[model samples]
Target: MTMQSLGDVVGNLVDGIGNERYWRGGKIAEPGVYAGVDIERYHHDPDLFDGFSISSSGLRALLRRPAEYWWSSPYNPSSQEPESKPALDFGKAAHMLLLGEDGFAGQYSLRPATYTDSKGDEKPWNGNATSCKDWLAQQAKAGRTVITETDIAHIRHMADALSRKEAIRLGILNGKIERSIFHKDRDIWLKSRPDVIPISSGDFVDLKTAASVDDETLSRAIFAHGYHVQAGLLRVIVREILGPDAFTSFTFVFVEKAPPYDVRVMQLKDADIDIGERQARQGLKLLRECLRRQEWPGYDGFDQHISYIEMPSWAKTRIDNELNAEAA
Candidate 1:
């Protein structure tokens, strides 16, 4: 969109991803979005903006706490590591089952021996068994994901629950899935891949697997995971590619990762989207500044002064009441 050739875009964003591992096979019918794009490739694609993505998670990691971001992000040479593989695996499985349609089975295998151990006793299968490991290696070789039987059950339960929702069902049954969309705005690269983008409607949905979707737990999860920022990013990217009227509404479908697999569907308010957009902008500005200076400064470098540590009001109230009772 910004007049860069496809080669330039690929060159800029191709640092981490090797040449052989391109977005293997999927193609999109949509006008602007790209299908079958790998997560890493989209993040690093140069077509968006100089091969840098102001991702929601990256922004949160950097702005929420610079020191942590420096340690975790690959941008830092001293302490770079991949994210939790188990969690990523679980989510990947869930997405495949919920959105990937027929291809989900090919990408995953359930451990047949996970139900028991050496003593033939029932165990949760920590994925450490030698046989399990060997099977997983084979799955990897075959370009498939290895998962525990329990993982299959959990994902299945969530899938069943999702099918009960007419709106979600129709969207999934009728729409496109897992297309990576990008937009360049103000010299910044932004991208979003909604779990489900209905071809027939102007609404998009993001599926989230969590501990619980109750009001309190979900709200905390939203804030902690920067779901608001993600919502804004997704909306903005979609709006740019499709049009201002493209994303009339956004929804979050939350399902418990554990038993009962309770599900909740939420539509974010306009105010929530606004707040997220604001945070995303701030994060992008900071990212631009950091890249331009070629320095990723930590928090200690900025405000190292020992500031006042305010106690929680609830804790203070409890302390005061206990002291009064003791005096009485």
Candidate 2:
């Protein structure tokens, strides 16, 4: 679940309610912004490994086509031709589970998680023939343990956190609130619909869950990318919602949730805002290159306009073997 606010969750657990909201969802056209790392890896086309032909103009043209234009929207891809590119499949994969909580269409395709045996042997748990109960029936038949309803609820909660907005709040605020004032009338939006309005904290809050937390490195980057770019966008929205004082300051909450939660509070200044705007323009240049090519977003983006990120020269370096081979 994505968190929007940072309230004390340690001892004041009873009095203070953490109004958590995730900013990663809703109506954003930017790919990978809302994508789960696992889902992004799963949906990416592995066959487009040849790299780009004209990586500059081709990519630029592709980005421009969709600023407010039409691209092919696939309806049903499994029945389509091989070269047609399973876009319908991609869209369906992204959104299918969002509409239903108990949906298990992806189950048949998913490989079982690795587990240990009773005798203390580790093995893979997939491609088996088993008939157990409903959820654990297959696992039991494969010499695996039966899963509890509580455990299943956890997995469902996790997937919803990744895919649906409804899961966002549930995953973030679970085992905490028994009755929430945020929802009256028996959780109408919470119960009836499969989604909720994308969360808004009325301010920017950036929380980083990592192994070892560093507040300094985090603030610099957040001030550079997350706060500055989003602040320009947020200023307009916040102004409309709560008037002009909303733009008076930029608020950032960075929380490192490991064994203990260490929270840091910081703000972005006018200079940092300038850096973010410059970076956004650099990003848009890459987007423009993508537009020119009609190429879809994929893992092999390094071949194109990603800002020559590590292109600066070092003091001393080994020869470029690939470049040498080409010359030879």
- Which candidate wins on TM-score? 1
Model 1 collision count: 1
Residue-by-residue lDDT tens digits, candidate 1, 1-328: 3444444433322321121122454422223466667665445333433445555667777778666666765445567544548877898788777776556666677667444566777765566776556766788789676777778888888888887877666563455665666677666556676776655556567888887778999888888888888888777777677655566667888888887788788887879888988888777877777778767777654555866778899999999999999999
Question: Cα miss at 242, model 1 (Å)?
Answer: 1.8
The lDDT values for all models are: 0.68, 0.34
lDDT of 2 by residue, 160-221 (tens): 33334332344322232111111111111000010211222223333233233476677665
Which stretch of 10 consecutive residues in model 1 shows the poorest summed lDDT?
12-21
lDDT of 1 at 205: 74
Off by over 4 Å in 2: 1-203, 219-227, 236-246, 281-328
Model 1: per-residue Cα lDDT at residue 47 = 43
| Total clashing pairs for each candidate | 1, 21
Predicted structure 2, TM vs. truth: 0.33
